[model samples]
Target: MTPPVYTTGQVVVNSGSPISFTATDASGGNRTAVFTGLTLNAGPNTIRVRGSSNSSNTTPFFQNYITVARASSTSVVSGTTTTPPTQTTISSPYTNSAVLAGGFAEGSLSDLLAMAPFVPSTNQFGSWAYGNSAKTVTNDTITIGWHKGLGGSLTILKDGSGPNLINNNASITTTYQGQTRRENGRQSDWAGYGTPFGYNQNGGGDPYTAYSPILNAQQRDSGIGYNWVAGGSISQDTSRILHYETRTINWDGGLRQVTYFKTQPMQWELRGVVDSTYRHVFYWLKGREVKVMFIIQTFRTDGQQKFRGRLQEGPFMYITAPHYRYFVYTGTNPTGETGTTGLTQINLSSPCEGAGTAGCPNQNDTGNWTSTGNWIGALDESNNGVFIVTPYNSNFVGKQFQSRSGDENSNASAYITAGPHLQNIDLPGTNFLASASYYVGSLTSFRTWYNSAGIVKMPFSFSFTPGKTNGWWSENVSGKLNSDNRYEINIGGNGGQGRFYSPEGSWMANTIDTIYVRGRFYGASSMTMNLQWKRPGETEIQIAQFNNKTFTVQGDGVERTYAVRMNGVTNWSGMIAFVKLTNPYPYGSFTGNEKFIPTYIGKTNPN
Candidate 1:
């Protein structure tokens, strides 16, 4: 079946004009369709494709929006003129059943944290190559250590005492599709680490967020791996800033695109998705706060087949320490609950029993819990802590937070499970959206941003017209969206940039704001892009570089009324979006809400 095509046409002034669009089939092939000798319409001409699923095709499916706009400098000749179709305003409406409003405070890491210390990796930074030696000394304290190859690294201590006693090493195992993928550290380690067959961990010591303290390869020891090899390399530019690879392949041998950069001050970010499953892990830094965002779309199988999938397994923060106080929101916010999740701790009958009266841990249990308000925070008497917050929506419809030991209830190797999971047949695309933050400071500091809607929910709505700008001379360039909502923009007829601009509105431009571009690199080696803001008079400035990039802008009136553009220098394909935040920095650094639909019509953070 032909995939549904959603598009908006820019009516040209010339009527009976011919327009053409090229499409890529499921088999890595291209087909072009042209329309000639046609009468034009005056207003928005909407073309809606009946959405359906066809998994049998082995070829890539694409949807292209061919817009024909009149040139600004076109001459008005006296001869018979061709009038193109009028510009189309695309809109799809739905109801929330209940009045749901979301808001946030936008600002930079400096604006948020001021002078708070920020470090991306510590000895607790676990990894296989570095021999992540994370051990639980007691129920309230833990010790972690790693080797830099020159000699055994110091046994760095966490909230623990007594000569850093090493307990039985807790081995964390992760499985995907019923197969063991990894068996150490967090589930992300196993799921994201380089393949099991190779030892060269690419991107080792690479910081996921921006502005991390510059550390040599030995100290950093973080990297992204694919197919038993380092997908790419990490090099420090003349500015002393380290740049990580933009793309890699997963063990499944699927292309996983990545882009990251450290914003000024203390913020950093990593954004992109694996094209195959559309499973995305986005990282953003606001001050000392590092928020790891998760997103996944539901898939529909052939109906004849039965399949069960785990949307998110573990954002597990294994604090091998003892005497830690923990709490999970019970959905009841009293008249004066101080925190967003009501700040209620789960009283434990025993360290291994999890919540009080909540008996033995069951590994077989899916551990899915229903929560209208989602968040969990664990803190020791010293105030060192780990916290997590997840959206309360269909995307993250279920909640699961479990405190476990080495064995079922052994308490020998303690860890916390805090993520979403789904177990049902023919599951719809589950977004499983959530974020987690770690703080070495007081919970009060974490509470300020957390309580202030650090990760606020905003109603997303927009009519997007995807096109590219060629040095502001070409009327419009062409592109198409793949089945995954990724764009294959061909903007190099004469070497120009690919631009995706949001609809015009008074709220489009915000003074003293920041912009973020989340993109993927599909191997167009010479292609590059950066976020741009064009003033009313054609004056434009690059607000943020977009080569697997993200950035923030300061100062007022930089461009009060301007169009935001994601300009690419050559033919490129992947996911991308231009986001504007009212805060000098993206208050919470979570801006992956605008990928599926290319535009948004909601209030900005300040609004």
Candidate 2:
């Protein structure tokens, strides 16, 4: 069982030195924490300390890691010489019964993110995503604040220094975990309750604080809170703000690690529970390319063994995953893993992650997806997955457009559209308040349902009248366009902001896949978004042509009226679309293979 290497060493200044040290503990006493660079060498040193359980105790440490070999002063010249054995010492400390008042340093994590600042309310208008200026703080230091998306109310600003910093207020909010992941519309765990998942049916706003039950045992003791409230009225930027600094709301409970707040007006969202015992990991660290989602079940029992994947990148290049299961809506369900086990009505599998499409590599439909069983309930289980979060969060406010030196922001560098014409090009810039995701697939036809593999969603401020802008949008999102509710695919166009075609707008279910789109785009003038995702010449935007495939059609003739065809291009010319369904779906669609996969998620409207 050779596995216990806790080493700490140092001390050897001055020319005369002869130090030898060796400290080893083969877990016999198992209780290791050796950290030093101050004293651990002088002549003969072998100090190993390991203790546990009401017995042998010796804990004393000043930890002054002073590892300087031989020094005759004079900066020691030549490699700053500080060589050899002049000191040797080791002490084992074990008595941390509380009182380790150290304070956020070792990897400070931006000092715990300057006290969780993703400011969501200065009295309204919060949802950030800027890169032209997010720093230079000095005036009011609340720097930036805004977020009315997904339940609002996490405002900040203690010193943004405005008309008396919002008339001298200090900002205070602390509701740890729960309401942030898998939120199903709040109720308990104390500390200001009620108002968890705001509503308009999953897109409502307003209701920042109220219903907190006095820290209700820190919500079952998951720990991670820091509320310094008071943030609003900072002026200049013209709307589209959203900031949130509320963390430790249980860090997804147990073993903590749901850390997020992606710098400045950036963004964040990482959830949990795919567990079968460690395997669900999503790390972008800082290369940026995240867009993930979780929750899948058509039939599962929870007894996982092993899944699969492939892709290697050392200092960068990471896209990992390990599970999905959504069983219980049987029309006659029955596939592999043997079946049985009873009771099931589960529903929740899309609080996705991964903004850079770690590995969806263009999947319209293939095969090979093994373990899914991890939907067990109880505790508030109103249907798990945090009661069903909008697959994590869907905040895509829009109005961003630009075109310089040519290459298309629109109006033609040949033919580049950001109007639900293909896949949302940031959707025109104005007050900017996107995050309008969609997911209600059903077209009981001759079989062939889309949106499930490498999703492509877009809906920022969708609502255009005037004969539906003469183009028509609303895969059922509403804005008056009823032809039975047309929408096969239309990313950006028609309405104000709408993309991520699932009714079947984007094509090419074949090669060159890579689909990962994270949200956040508030603009007045920071435009230039193009993601044909491949529709120009490399050839790929085919489905009506019946190539870029995506299906779900279940039993019985599959239905009919299937006339699919989609294509798009920017640097030169090409645009086309079509979508019509009469009756389809009973079950038979869900293929993305693996890895924090998500196409879109937008929420906010509890107003």
TM-score of each: 0.30, 0.18
lDDT (0 to 1) per candidate: 0.28, 0.19
**lDDT of candidate 1 over 160-193, digit per residue (tens):** 4433211222233322112222222222210221
- Candidate 2 per-residue lDDT over residues 1-607, each given as its tens digit: 2222222333333343333333333434433343344342333233333333334432221111112344436352232111211112211111111110111011111222222222222321122321211211122122222122212211211223431110111122221111111111111000111111222322443212211121111111121111011111121101112222222233211222221221111000101011111001111111111111111001111212011011100001000011012222111111112222332433222222321255422111111111111111111121211111111111101111111111101110110001121111111110001111111111111011111222222221122211111122222222221232211222222232332332112222232122222222322122222232222123333422332333222222222221122223222122112222211121112121111111121122211
Cα RMSD to native, each candidate? 25.5, 26.8
Best model number under TM-score: 1
After superposing candidate 1 on the true structure, give the runs of residues whose Cα lies further than 4 Å from its correct spot.
1-182, 185-280, 295-311, 321-324, 330-336, 339-341, 351-373, 381-383, 392-414, 417-441, 458-607
